[model samples]
Target: MRRVSEANGLRIWVDGDLRDEATRVDAVARFQTLLGILRAWRSEAGELRDEQRAGLGEGPVCDEAGNQFLSIGPVRTYTTFGGEIEWFAECTRRGVGMSQHLRNALWLNGRLNRTAADFYMIHEYAGVEFGGSLGIRDKLKLSTNSQGRLTRAANNLSPLEGGRHAKQSGEAGMTLDEQRTYVADLLRRWINLHSAA
Candidate 1:
């Protein structure tokens, strides 16, 4: 049996049979990575509370018992676009009707900004599902390389912003809001296509 305990706002799993030191270290590393991903999602959702911020303190994260933990800081709110209540309701309805995996992919895509890392993550999560024999790109009339070009452009912008790679010398050819719209449309079409299949 595995015993779970919470510390520094993270769940630590203690397994009795797992005695390998390297495996235990790897499991902790993976758990930390997963925690970071969840924290990023929570930040994107703008759900961080003041108390949580206070608990994080000014330096590295430490529990009340003075046990030092991962260097993760408190999530800060970003300027995310807010839509109408009715539109949000419609989106929620559509998401609720989809399969769990598809819904998660779409949700993560929607929460992302117009950064190269965001584009790459989106592609990794939803692209394969819609690509290949599914013909989603063709149905949307997107060029064979449209997704790739967008991802490259986002990654290769000049004077790199937001800690993403910027080795090229041009813009993404679309504004942030435009990119958001395009991704939203793509996800909507995917949902429609999958539902009909």
Candidate 2:
């Protein structure tokens, strides 16, 4: 658990190029807003894993007595625990409706690096589940970009790819909205696709 927690945390590094006071504030505000909006969004739809939440406890948070903060800081800079970075943005793998994909582009690329040339965001899902069993499922893996087409070929490499559409339809058929929602979520989660200055 400690290893996963350490490996999964976001560690943002700045190269001293953070200039312009307003840009810095706007950047900070954007991250702040994204966290707020996403939190509301998650509340409406339900978080992906309540079990994980239970074990991990709330994040970016500390109690005066080391308990719970309820709504913790999403974008924390320096930390006695984690390193300097923008956020501990919680991921939502389920129930994220459509239109979020476009929003993700706007937030991650548009918001995450307001004062710098670029930044890195690290996200880890509990891993994808196809069947009740874990061994032969088509779990999501990271990609170089957010474009779904580019990654589809790679995903097809899995033996499970043979009946994915049918299996997906059988298990949980996404309405067009659900389809777009999960697709967008998957895109945001897997896309290593970063932005430049």
TM-scores for all candidates: the values are: 0.42, 0.20
Q: Pick the candidate with the highest TM-score.
A: 1
Backbone-clash count (model 1): 0
Q: Which 10-residue span in candidate 2 carries the lowest summed lDDT?
A: 115-124
Query: Residue pairs in steric clash, candidate 2?
Result: none
Q: For model 1, how does the per-residue alpha-carbon lDDT over 1-197 read when each residue is reduced to its tens digit?
A: 12233532435465544788877875655454333233223323322343234432434566799997655565464432563333433544464366554555544553323344554454455555556423546654556566756565566655343224636655565544344455555555555555455
Q: Could you give the C-alpha RMSD of every candidate to the true structure, in order shown?
A: 10.8, 16.5
- What's the C-alpha lDDT at position 54 in model 2? 36
Q: Write model 2 residue lDDT over 76-175, tens digit each, in one string.
A: 2323345211222323222123234424433443332121111111111212121211311233443333323222322332224322332232222222
| C-alpha RMSD between model 2 and the true structure | 16.5
lDDT of 1 at 90: 51
lDDT of each: 0.48, 0.31
Pick out the ten consecutive residues of candidate 1 with the lowest summed lDDT.
39-48
Task: Give the per-residue Cα lDDT of candidate 1 at 120.
Answer: 48
